[model samples]
Target: MTARTVRGAVGATLAAALITGVAACSNPSPGGAADAGGADSAVVGIATEPESLSPLLGYGKDGNSKIFDGLLTHDAEMKLQPALARALPEVSADGRTYTYALRQGVKFSDGAPFSAKDVVFTYRTILDAKTNNASKTELDAVESVEARGEDTVVFTLKYPYAPFAERTVLPIAPEHVAGGQDVNSGDFTTRPVGTGPYLLTGWSKGEKLSFRANPGYWGGEPAVKKFTMAVIKDDDVRLTRLRSGELDAAILPPNLARAFEKDGTRTTFAARTFDYRNVTLPTQHRVTGDLAVRQALDIAVDRGAMVDKLLDGAGKPAYGPVPTGSPWFTAGTERAHDLDRARRILDDAGWKAGEDGIRVKDGVRASFPLWYTSGDKIRQDHALAFASDAKKAGIEIRTEAGTWEVIEPRMKTDAVLAGGGSPADPDFDQYQLLTSSLGGDGFNNMARYDNPTVDRALEDGRRSGDPAARKAAYDTVQRELVKNPGYVFLTHIDHLYVVNDRWEGLGTQVEPHDHGLGSGPWWNVESWKPKQK
Candidate 1:
């Protein structure tokens, strides 16, 4: 397909919104008047409003965390734990089947009893072609789901997908509430009901969202009384609000989080995350289209310097798609800075350095606009640093911080500073963003990369559950991808948050790209307790 068509198709959805999460929240029971105790409520600042609360949309970008309960949830350490389910899922040794035992007597916020059917409906909706969730690929391994009984839900996967358990960290919506509605644009998209510990009391859109505790929560009453998620897109404004006591907590860039440490306004909570940040080089563009230029761009970046200076050493350089210590991480993928080699590679590829120090090939100057969210200081810093490093390699990188709406159309031709990764494994990490088949879904494969070798290895990894086989397959994928790098990876950021000390239950979270306001600091708000008198 042509470049323009690709951009239009992919940019329409993926860039719009989506992501992973937790479930629960506070007092006055759900929907009761914001009691006189509203002063004790926890207010958080988020960078974006959620695209939708429907689990079909991966619980959205906004982090309305308390309203939905997933079959599985992550602990503060990011390890898999049971939420709606009674306990950890039982996986078949063959790797194709997963069985979850529903927690009996659990009730949705609306008072409906939780059932295995809810689990079945959730997956069925996401897999259905009519469902509009762009992140459906996260569950692509599931071939079928069946409610074997009132308490047991079984999932049959197409393969022994290694990351199947983590993918279950999705909200299980009540069928009685959302069943017949349009799965794509249903009432549940905005108004949600699940077996979570809180109810979504209010959503003002672009302003703030309100929540109250689910009194019938299976886990017992949460200590927090009321919860508010305020949308503050500007990084500085978010910090300012936290200082002024407008918000009890906020996620800040590493530098900003560090600044607040000594301010005494809020205590910084830094957590390790699989949130991988990389610059996608769209192959459709002439400047970035050249494979040699892409490789040189990879070598040109000083990943260590970006980590040290930009992140204030709060992050580690990302070599491949996975974290450094991950079993799937390919050690050979990590490389040291070699600027002379980068320039030589470009020169050998027929790119000639002009008098102005910009590389030119044919009639095209090696220049393209790099896009990022304007409010994200992390991406902005990464972009500026990227441009500086590219200049050294005679490749001009013009950084543009456009709103997602503005950046969507240009995703076809421009490079983008994007962030994503999964709590699952490398499959979740690589499949959506790197695969060629998933290109039209906004953020997935925005780079427009196509390589049959890498594709086959990725397929192999997904199609088998044998550890040895999967390892062999993924190992090949890493090596092949590094040989023709599609992204100039910078650093895997440590998600940082600052919260007030009024409550005692807040804990660190293993965040994903889809972190919502509720998903981070508020993951277990229901468990937070006021310091005892």
Candidate 2:
């Protein structure tokens, strides 16, 4: 999923009532009686500071906002559940409206009573034209939000969006504190007041964020007393801290994480992280724009070897948009590498190979620069490895490390090594990646793909509520997606996390694009307790 949409747009980073306490004594592994989280607390190492704590901003998008909460929340499994809202919405027969009944007696960290007004206000702010949220597109389907009573809030949609429930997963801002203020620039962004189990107590700007358990939390008191996320920008530094017991939990790239398995510093591998890495082929570029060339790249790359060697058996090769666990995954969506077929396809398309082995078509060399974010070692490694393999197929792949600021401007003409996936709805995870309407901005579909079949399938999947129909729609989309590849689909990285064994109740679940601070392994941190001997 993605900001550009995960129905959670990748990290989230949305609607909830699915809040239920894990069995207080159900230790994930064999352990003694653990002290319930009261004054008990620990520090975690994170790579990036949260962009913002404001609900209108990117803070809660990773699905781990310690302060704010919405009517709905998700469980460890990512199923929609109740947090502040009383329960899941009551959908209207027409499917354009969703009405939710607010939970009673719940108060924000600052003691402000939560009401349906808060929900309406939060939704309205997101829909506001002046808001600077990258995910404003996520709320575009909502035509209006109504507070029918003190406890009732209803949403009317512009269309029958099947992922509407998923879209409602945003963290609700406190209408009392955030209602009239200019959320774009305000003190509330940093000093947020929330209704969840934990309250933000301190932010050390680029250093750390600290929180304390909320005594008034409706879900029984949170066991974790003091939660601190230390900001360590470098992976090596973070791991170094992890080994020294400075970090209670840390997310590591596969290559680095593999080493922690035997260190007694416990590691949790969240199996099907919908997150996948792919090479985005900008459709406007002559070398990449041709359908044959896209297909040739797909066949030429050795996805299995990349997973086995680069990822250290921590990932699954991807051929299509959706990851394996999703119901929409098809058998032939990703095929084994066939360099011979790739070569034939290129030659038949009239591309002639030069003396140096790069193909040429219509006076244009079959070569393009692939861009990856500067900091991600995995992306860098993948890019360099891909360049090495593509040479055998007579394709010149130039790998470049650039920041998003520079790469965003040149996405239409340059290739990018991108990653994203969501554990929510199938349409939520892959729709924007192929929609023709989203082609120009290319927020998700950076490759600028506009296949009519894929577009219809995406719209159909979102416009209907029928499970079978949605499945059929996505199946059609995938079948078509494989034939006209937009990205050289790589591997779905297994989210690897290392945590000290001091705490009980640490469990693994599917992860999103955003890691470390949010939904990786700490989503249910409030339920943790010290391992009893």
Pick by lDDT: which candidate is best? 1
Please name the candidate that would achieve the greatest TM-score relative to the true structure. 1
Report, for every candidate in turn, its global Cα lDDT versus the true structure. Answer: 0.76, 0.75
Q: lDDT per residue, candidate 2, 414-505, as tens digits?
A: 99999877666676557667777777453567888979998888888887778788888988888886798888888888877787777888
* lDDT of model 1, residue 157: 92
| Residue ranges of candidate 2 with Cα displaced over 4 Å | 1-39, 265-267
TM-score of each: 0.90, 0.89
Q: Distance (Å) between predicted and true CA of 102, model 1?
A: 1.5
Clashes of each: 9, 30
Candidate 1 per-residue lDDT over residues 1-533, each given as its tens digit: 01123333342233333211112222322322222224457777877766666776566322235777788877776778887788999988898999999888988887778888888998898777766666677678889999988999999998778878878877888889889776655566777887777778776656667777777788886767677777777888887777766777888888788777676535778777777788988888888888999899888899999999999999899876687867778777787788999999999999999999998999889989999987787888999998999999998888888887788778888988887776567777687767788764566788878888888888888778778988888788778767888777778878888887677877876666666565676777888888665
Candidate 1, superposed: residue stretches over 4 Å from native: 1-40, 60-64, 263-265
